[model samples]
Target: MITTLLVANRGEIARRIFRTARAMGLATVAVYSDADADAPHVREADQAVRLGPAAARESYLNVEAVLAAARATGADAIHPGYGFLSENAAFAEVVTAEGLTWVGPPPAAIRAMGLKDAAKALMIAAGVPVTPGYHGESQDPAHLAREAGSIGYPILIKAVAGGGGKGMRKVERPADFTEALGAAKREAAAAFGDDRVLLETYVARPRHIEVQVFGDAHGQVVHLFERDCSLQRRHQKVIEEAPAPGMSDEVRQAVCAAAVRAARAVDYVGAGTVEFIADASAGLRADRIWFMEMNTRLQVEHPVTEAVTGQDLVEWQLRVAGGEPLPLTQDEITLNGWAMEARLYAENPAAGFLPSIGELEHFVLPESVRVDTGVEAGGAVSPHYDPMIAKLIAHGPSRRVAAHRLAAACAQVQVWPVRTNAGFLARCLEDADFLQGEVDTGFIAARLDALAGALAPSDQVLAAAAQGLLSQTPVPAAEPQGPWSALTGFRINGPRQGQVRLYRDGQAVTAPLVDGPLSADVLLNQAGAIVVFEAGEAFAFTGSPPQAITGEGPAGDGVVIAPMPGKVVAVAVSAGDKVLKGQTLVTLEAMKMEHALTAAFEGVVETISVAAGDQVSEGVVLARLTPSA
Candidate 1:
């Protein structure tokens, strides 16, 4: 039995694992980099050890550093909390070789299911259904293009070595295949160090469903039902729920049974997920479902499953790793209620979901839900890691109640300075199609405009901002001050209604406020104020001196700047080159994704400021353009 545990990851997931370990009376150890020395996870652990710099490769991904920390801390086991090196076979093997408990699936199973192509072959041999695709060893561009032609149009190119939509692209036409393939290969090589890819027939309207299966050394393998992760943007899950809606009894049984068969075939022990893609074009059917891939580690969306089933999966992992039998039989485990989770990320939705990095300034969550986060009100959101702020989970006896409650909670959350996707998530929950169980992988893509569009501040929101600004100014004890004091709208003649111009997201709004006693319900901090009104979310605003602001540079200035702090991965333009509007000029990579900076208007390149492989800061000009002569 293990008495001490070391977590081999960082951020919220690491903090989550430590919560269970501390509750179970086990001494917990946390590994962090220089960037996370002041992080919440470090404070939560009983002990922490510094690995190295902020770059993941130098710290969390360094297997030797993690192992050394475990040894130094005298930890008896290591729990890799679902990212970085969690699914690495060599890491697991080394842990077991060193006589430490590996709190995950066996190394053999991880290796077998590491690559998408090899895993599909293994699943096929195990009699599990798979999607139609070319998962061959040949990776020649010409050969793959030929295979794609034979397979048909509208195909998906995916990285065989990684998941999370890193190296995935959808080609809708033959003319775009080459470009898509090159992008997929580049991303795959950067993320997984493997440039190999696979081609698969695209499912137009697909529901992404996966089964949660657990096994122990006693030869007992049982499934914990299914979760629907179809609500996604850019192939990354935005929202997830347990017990897929519209699932029939027959289809559920068939899918779960197949998942069990796949797990047992690999002699899997511990928690694993068997993901499937169901063709929901005509609604869900057992015959229309096919295997996509298997994740040999605990998933990020595991909390919803726990909420519906009343089980702590982390506890199960601990016990199973200590040679315990399955806690419950297949027939004993049953789902009780509906659960939903919304991932709150630090991103600006109106700016094409570009990540926003800065101090959190203020962080508050509703009391009605379960919130898992690793940052506090004064914490910093660094550019060196993923920008997810928290996971808000809600559970109710029915799906409708759960969905509505979760949506309200998402909207009620208040995070300042660093913007979030809270409003965007609320729109998705309130959407008519989503509430009616009409979700699919393509649902977000189809309705992105309606869901993530720029939100205009309402009249009430503007009024609240005005009220907050007035409340901050001090009232004079002596009457009859200078005219400058009247800026507060403190006119002695009758009720004075004055306007205040507030700028938000680069737009200005003028709000009218009446001179009166301020309300005591306003919440304020050094950075801003949050005013709560009737039936509306607490409006967060910061007071700015009145001025006419021009959001653009001076006339004739056409400079392309980096949107975020990232490494310059590619530069496609040079000085003296004519460019068209919206043409890709450079690609900046941050948070494990690439973002292309495009030309704002047609012009000639005046100068190039940066080159490929150079690290650049946010708003640094990469290229400048002038009108063609």
Candidate 2:
């Protein structure tokens, strides 16, 4: 009998579990690191505990700290929300051994499906079709090449350990196999400490479609249909939707049946996902889809599944952990409508999707969609964790309606100072190919250039910004009302005719005043910039600052400032060193990504303000350069 529940995680997923825990009449406890002390998940829980410092290893991933939190809160059940230790088999064992309910699958099941090679073998043994690959223990390069030849050209070399597209490489030619294999092995070793890899035939046009499977302790497993996750960037899912666009009834039955068989093979309990890879070169078919891998915990995209099936997955986890039978049988479960979800992250897409950490000075999400988030308007996006702060979901009777709704919702996001990928996501959802349901894993990569291009406020947005600026500057009470007078500000009855020059992306745009006022939302951010929400994208404009005020680049004239808050990892140049334009100067590490700061022009380094170990905030000068004579 589970009474109180402790979520051994943070951010959106933790809060997501807590929401369900509350509705089920169960108390909820939250554990957070120093970085997440004021996180939304913490305040929402009935009880909260501080694990340790800002580092995840000292807090979230520290098994002892987590157990202590649960014990202190008197929590009888623990839910390992996705990521961190959600897939750790040993953690699951420890939780159960402590006489506390583990809201997940058995430790044996997690271990069975932990490694790619072993998982495939189990699937094959269970009569579940898997991708044609070599999962043997032999690591000889020559032998692996031979197997690749049999599997045909364009094969993938994937590490057997962890996921998230790390330690994975695609070899399209026989000659490149050896080189790609070595690189994949090196990365695999560095990432997971295991160089062993498996090879599979690379599908020409691959679509990532996975079945959401739920099993109970009573030996019954049911599928909640499938979700199309083909819209991805570097194998990380960006946009996902339930009931794949073109999935036929026959194809769905075949894949879902295989998923059920795979789950039963390990006597799986609780929420799990069986991912499948489909060769969509000839469109989705029963014979084209093959088993990929299984996620032993609730997936990040589970909300879309719930939207389409009208079921609460977290409640299912709790009920099952309490030894209850399946809530609804296979026949009773049904897919209702099309549901789409876009991952809302605090990152700058135009700058290669680097994490952007700062206070949410002007945060506001769209009210037209279902939002699941772990941060608030006044919260800060911390660099100590993942950048994803929320998930936006939209459900409709048809796929097109859902896509349009989600796209509009993406456009309605109003975050400022801290950059976001909202604009990029809106473009992806509104893309012509995406709208027509023509997508594959490489869809985003193929059109990333256009999708992530630097966005400039539209004429309408410029007009809105100009009006907002005019309205706020306190117009002189003595201004002329004559038709010939310069109409510099917005008129109460209509838009006064005038021209306002606004700078965007370093270029000045001359915006002609609209004949009427716009319905666009506008706000004055803390940075003293006039912010206009274009569909939800924040367009901050300045009212033509002084010519000398470039905002950055002090009198030294060659200042290199940190683009975002990060730790200085390397100083490539010293005082008195000459460097060419575009040469690497310093490398900054933030949000698990490394960014190289470069010399904007040929110059001599005059001073070094930071070292390799120093943590720097955005706009902090890292080095000063003087133009070479």
Candidate 3:
């Protein structure tokens, strides 16, 4: 029996696992880096240990440090939540070798499916349907280009190791193959420490469906249905739902059976996901679906499955790892209500979805829905981890009702200076195409313009802001237009109407306020200049004073600055180098993702301030460029 459980991860997943472990009367330990000393997970655990510095390699990903922490904490088992070393075969092997139970599938199963190339071969040998691709050992760029030609145009280049859409690129033509290959390798190497890549035919109009499968030490395996992660942006899942829309019983049965077979083939134990890609051009069909890959750990979107199946997956993992059989037989398992989960990220949809870093000054979500989050109000969102702030899940008897509740919850998210993708997610849930279940992997990309459009502050929203700024309460409708109605410096008895200056998106606009005091509910968060008002949808406004700039040059001429807190991964140019517009000046790796900084216009490089390995904070100048002489 496991008495003490140490979670070998951090953030929301760590808190999630602890909730289950503590409920089961087990002592829980949390490991955190220097950056997360005060993180919620640290306080949530019975014991907390410092791993190392903020860099993942020296901390969370350092297997020796993790094992040492478990031993120090007297933990009998280590739960490698998701990400980090969750699917690392070596980590699992080391934990078991140390005589501590590893709360995951065996190391052999992880190794069997760790590499995409090897996993595909194993799947083919097991008679599981596989996508046609080049999974060869030779990673020669020229050879891979030739294979892409053989596989036909519009092929997908995927890193042989790792997941989460890193190191993956879509090549639309032969001309772009080489550059794409170089980029794919760099990202793959940085993310997974592997540069090898494989090619496959890009499934047009594809739907990403994955089945939840579980197994036991006693060789029992069963599936708990599938989730549709079709709505995606830049290959990352944005929203997910269970009992995929438009799924037929025939296709569901076939996919679930295949998932169980895949699990049993690996002698899989605990929770794992078998992902499949289906061609939705002809709607849901059993034969059109092909195996994608398997996630050998719990998924980020597991709450939707839990909501629909009425099961706690973490509890099952603990039970299975403790020498127990499968908790429920396949015949006894059944799906109930329809459920949906929307991931709220600390990012700006209007600003290329670049991750934002700051304190959650005024974070608040609707109490009506299930919100799983690691940070609270006033908590910091560090650049050292994923930008996801929380996940909002909703369940109902029907898909329409679930979608409606989830959409409402999205709009109710109130955050401050650090912008969020709540508005973008709200738009996705309310879009007609998504509501009708006409979504695919390309759904967000195709409708990005509409989805990321800035919402102009409505009249009511303006009034609420005015009320909060003026420090006025709701007045009766019968009240006549009085002298104190407007916000302005008054001269003697002034008129009731006047213009109020409000800044939004850095532009100051005059909102005309008429009559007496505004009659609307308004809330002002003292931490920042924010005003919140809840009607059919919740809307919040951050007031900013207009800025005056003296320069009349190009918008990005002066200096190239780091957009967010990150490390300088590569510097492509040096001082005195002449560069054309759109030339890449440097590459910055932030949040384990690479972002290229480009020359805004034709210019001459004046100075390079940072080196390849230097860590930088937001707005730090990396290089300066002057106009051509």
TM-score of every model? Answer: 0.93, 0.87, 0.91
Residue 96 lDDT in model 1? 94
Cα TM-score of candidate 2: 0.87
lDDT of 1 at 290: 96
Question: Model 2: C-alpha RMSD to truth?
Answer: 4.7
lDDT scores in order: 0.86, 0.87, 0.86
> Which residue ranges in model 1 land beyond 4 Å of their true spot?
474-498, 505-507, 514-557
Candidate 3 lDDT at 110 equals 95
In candidate 2, stretches whose alpha carbon ends up further than 4 angstroms from where it belongs are: 138-153, 171-196, 474-495, 546-589, 592-629
Best by TM-score: 1
